[model samples]
Target: MKNNKPDQQLASRRNFIKGSALAAAGFFIVPRHVLGGPGFIAPSDRLRVASIGVGGMGAGDVRGIFSSGKVDMIALCDVDDTRAKQSREAHPKANYYKDYRIMLEKEEKNIDAVSVSTPDHMHAVQALMAMKMGKHVYVQKPMSHDIYEARMLTEAAEKYKVVTQMGNQGSSGDGVRQMVEWYNAGLIGEATKVWTWTNRPVWPQGIPWPSTPIAPPADLDWDLWLGTAPYKDYVGNLVPFNWRGWWDYGTGALGDMACHIMEPPFRVLGLGYPSSAECSVGSVYVGEFQRGYFPDSCPPSSHITLRFERPGKEELEFHWMDGGIQPTRPEELGPNEMMGDGGNGVIIEGTKGKMMCSTYGANPQLLPTSRTKDVSLPQTEYRVPGGSSGHYNNWVEACIAGHGSEEFKKLSSPFSVAGPLTESVLMGNLAIRSYDYRIPRTGSDNQFDYPGRGIKLVWDGANMKITNFDPANQFVKRTYREGYSL
Candidate 1:
């Protein structure tokens, strides 16, 4: 698909030249205070940012980026006025618009960077547009809605030569870095099995879509809110939240939390795409004994296993559980001890020992808990300033420094790394969706048959295809609405 319009193409070329010129002459440029007022910041010293979906997590992202004291939030965009109110009130000097497309078009030259905190489905389209315009991007976690979008965004970052960061803040945390060091020192040995769990679906899932639609709120531009997703009538409770359960918009539990919970293992193990995927999902009982079938919504609970091939080592078995499901606890812990912060956590079992951590890789501990106190390892990985809290400023500084600079190299979750990780996370979702793939039975006692159940789907990660089941490949990519493309 053509990624840019004629005007956008011109703007992209102009922006590229402008960025190149600024990078070339940055060292020689005079201080802004010398040229203007004492409070003025030089173009090279400040990052002018525009934020899309400036509400919910987006509001926090805006606050974090602005707190860097080196960012000028020049533009803000959101489809809902009520949701954008907080950012608008906070950044009164910034321009505001409901449509991101118009904001990008009008303010293209003014923005040096863009932050996209939209839903999973719209992430690729919004971020791609900014990247094509030579704007550095900080996208929210589960970088894209599908495997294809993730791969495309990964390639685009390199092609555009822009500094990029994904919103999995844990990647920048000291805990993850500490875990990496310990793992490198053979503390956990060679990890063979990894388990991650979450108590999500804090929204709702495994239920049928609302039978009736309601009018969208007066403050909301419902059409714009449904950007890349298929057009659907406004439904109650879907605006501010609750969209996470629907397949049309959100990516369910796996997409919601796996990026945060799975990153430590993914980074420590130097993992790549999975070689195979399979899953078993919890079903809801409808009235009495009948099982609920709602393909349009994510299942209420699920247990997914993915296998990653290692060149010289045994294949790694990675397990993900959601809807309060958890793996069997290691016997090394006391019966009363909490496993993974009581709600969400990760455990990596290796030949020698096991290590565990809570969400975002916080509070990392070795198995038996006592081993964590005496063991020490040299710090091999660079920790981001302020740890996880420094994630926003890290990207801001990197953008100001320009791509390929030293600061850029220190990025925690650039698309190059986030893309593969996100793809792996979404692989679990693929297995879940495939598990619900139903077929009509011909001249049989059963009304419907599920061939995908109880079968391991062989994956060709490079090709983004499920080799064993052709039907499962349908979830790898999706058709966007009429006005959007990626």
Candidate 2:
């Protein structure tokens, strides 16, 4: 897993980051002092890249980087041949393969990076391989399937000297950057509470647990699709798209959307990993819903809670509601108020005022008519010029600059920020698994068990382990398959 030569080069680039002048088309260009160091590959110089799991999201990533004109699309790999064929059609010049490992082994010298858009279960393994080869990575959202994978990915990237960016495109939006500026300027003074909500129950609910496994589809390499995950027979629901609701291949409702909804709070408040997390759901609701994507079971609905300690600042509480459960707005806000308290959004209530923003960092509007009138955002030279093209261009620009600029180095959101958010959401999934076994909330004086069996599970991020509950710790890492030990 060591790529020392390339890593040393990247270290050199970190020392050379300089120049602040704006280039043509408003893009920042670095002076030669910043561009001459090691790990600095020129934009015009040929760079090779590969795509792993080039289905739904992967296909889009392939096209985006292709448009950037910074690299050659050398290889496309996926467990599904149908999508693989489509990827080949989309990029006729690229080579295609069923197994990513085969592609990596055969095309190792040509590739400098990898765009991993695989299912949650496969992210760490594919990305790990790419990093081991001294390749930069563009991994999709919910960066890891579990807490351990998040830590592992970060370590591997650092060890390998690869430029990395998570695929939470919303993090690149100007709206999010604006939110961070506002938060920093104290517009939302010492924010105490934050809420993120989503309407996700509609897709995978109302159906009971699936009993039997069906034959694998003709186009899928079922074994490869199940890479690094628990062994299971193929099921139709697991294919194409729809896998985000299942525990085996996905991280459930919160994992699927938390990265997007939780983006603003993480970046603005500098909130790290939560100290502990809990879940609550209606008593009537059982594991009545069948996992639409994989052969598993999940609760009909739940309200997940995550808490963080920010010494010298307000303690933050992030509440997640799926299936349309929502937070009650502060009653004091008078009439003519509009709240983004619907399916996807974050509500920040501070000492001075409150703000509501749509999910994916769009449609940001401060609450309370007076707050918008009075509060002012701080002036900063760096502003993310917003557009609809998504995060693709941002990474492309970084890749083109290579080691010469701070492009990707300056951008760490969706990865570092999304890690804990995704971990907190995974706690919701843990709560459901341990619904009959409630745990004590750390720092609480009461000895009585929670009203329901849900996790108030304590987290220890520095150690990369969950405290208090052994069962919850079981989820920190997956039981990787025999051959693939990620």
Candidate 3:
């Protein structure tokens, strides 16, 4: 009892030292939940957040997070001043910066989280930096450009001890949950096949890159926007959204919309890496006889098939159709009934029945509309407060809870889930790229052998490579620009 007095005095000394160290760091974020567990956090405490690539979809994502009203939008960064106009106007209080590098460096102490919504090539690098600093990160979909990048961020999210999410808002929706419940309830017995399609590439593809480059716009930082891609002069249409067609910048239609459309099947089936992948791309003829091969661009259309193995279940035949393609209608539905919400949808055929859903897993239905009306299953999965729209808040609250907290485990699109899904999506692109590979033949004019054509590539997911087709492995991991790397 007498020694207890010295113990109290030592505790006072420890608190004094801790406060001094924080003072030296200028400012430190002490999430309320960290000070006092879960429910003890005060209502007034707010998450401090920043946005990168605040334009177009990125702008919308930023607004969604802001609308959550749980966090303070502290900073905004984008390469194009013109593109950033809307966000800057909306969050006038936030600090604005042209380069993300500068913004992260100056705002590191103040930021608690970051939203990375840049081009596919930039997602991994930006997200990795924030996580490494122990800041939560919410990255936009397709998760990453290459398989390796996807795996990197997936692993980094845990190693850095930071909460993380990939912006596939559909994953947070009610429809997917309903579909999952239905599957578990045995409504769709044992799924063996799935079909996902999209009408995308609204921008041009299957054409040669423009020969002349235009002067960089005064408001746009072409180099910063380029990020990890090889330096190139600004091309008019590539900005403000046509980048979807290019291999170096975008992942084409599959990357553009698959995350939203294919999420249902991936979730309901409890899928994992595919055992093998193959695809047939729609080709364009350059002239009368020559096939137009734009190595720099994604194909106009593609039909890919991936085979996934389940431990004790039937193997899955997952089909991805893009460039305005559609799957066959299920016989169980009326002829007039819509098949997969018109343009983008997915159909999973099981041993017992079929289930379908539209983009974002919205408008889910059983094969026969009447069946959906009469059927009901016990709801087992948790629904976000606002369904699909609640994706932003899902991350906001998790960041507030502190990484590895119970709330963090509830995130809808944590990299652990998104990483493998993205890898699956990117796997199809590998098949497409390999489909277009050509090798010149000796003693012939414009004649070449396409070795990768018509071959099924066996994937070794553990090693992140194509076990059978060595040439197709190049796209698995991309080379980063010297200055920027994960």
Which tens-of-lDDT digit does each residue in 233-330 have in candidate 1?
99887868899899989999999999999999999999999999999999899989999899999999999999999999999999999999999989
**Could you arrange the candidates by TM-score from highest to lowest?**
1, 3, 2
In order, candidate lDDTs are 0.94, 0.72, 0.89
TM-score, one value per model: 0.92, 0.82, 0.92
- Model 2: lDDT of residue 363: 73
For candidate 2, write residues 290-380 as lDDT tens digits: 2232225455567878888898876688888877787886564565554564567788888977777887877776666466656665666
Choose 2 or 3, whichever is better by TM-score: 3
In order, how many clashes per candidate?
A: 0, 0, 0
Model 2: how far residue 224 lies from native, Å: 0.9
Output the number of the lDDT-best candidate: 1
Q: Which stretches of candidate 2 lie over 4 Å from their true place?
A: 1-46, 205-209, 282-295, 332-338, 369-378, 385-390, 412-414, 436-455
Tens-digit lDDT string for candidate 3 (146-172): 989999999998798888888899999
Clashing pairs in model 2?
Answer: none
Model 3 has an lDDT value of 0.89
